[model samples]
Target: MPGRTRPIDKLAAAAAKCTKEGSVYGKCIMADYNNVHKDKCITEFLKLKECYLTAYKKR
Candidate 1:
């Protein structure tokens, strides 16, 4: 049997997908840890938040 996926893991996967898709802001925000918290990555942050909430509710 497979273990349950963590919320953080889901968020990481989403971020990885976003990074691969790329954005007008460039890959810096998606690829760099420091930039993850910056304004440029606000959209990505929201995506992660949504994933977290969904995962939390599922648990």
Candidate 2:
């Protein structure tokens, strides 16, 4: 496992690849932080999730 990446590292890499989507999702949530409405950022969250999945698969 000399050159293998740890699971946490892979997760971080996938997250890094989806930073833009994550940021959008985060902003959407922060926009209504106190309100806590459901599905308000579903679109953004889905995009981030997809990006992370794709990135993780590619690794």
Candidate 3:
């Protein structure tokens, strides 16, 4: 596994690339952790998901 990239490493890289989106999504979730409802943060989550997908595809 010397030259092979680990799956976790790839994930970390993608997360780093999507930090802004992730932070926004995380904040939205934390804002209402007790009474979270469906689609409450769907917009933020979708943005984060798109960022991660784009980052992963670039690898």
TM-scores for all candidates: the values are: 0.38, 0.82, 0.84
Task: Sort the candidates on TM-score, descending order.
Answer: 3, 2, 1
Candidate 3 per-residue lDDT, tens place, 1-59, comes to: 89999999999999899988999999999998999999999999999999999999998
lDDT of 1 by residue, 1-59 (tens): 27988767766655555443345335546477564553767675566556555555554
Clashes of 2: 0
Candidate maximizing lDDT: 3
Comparison by lDDT, 1 against 3, better one: 3
Model 3 segments more than 4 A misplaced: none
Give lDDT tens digits, candidate 2, residues 1-59.
89888999999989999889998999999987998877888899999999999999996
For candidate 3, list the clashing residue pairs, or say none: none
Q: What is the lDDT of residue 44 in candidate 2?
A: 92
How does model 1 fare in lDDT? 0.56
**Order by lDDT, highest first:** 3, 2, 1
Decide which is better by TM-score, 1 or 2. 2
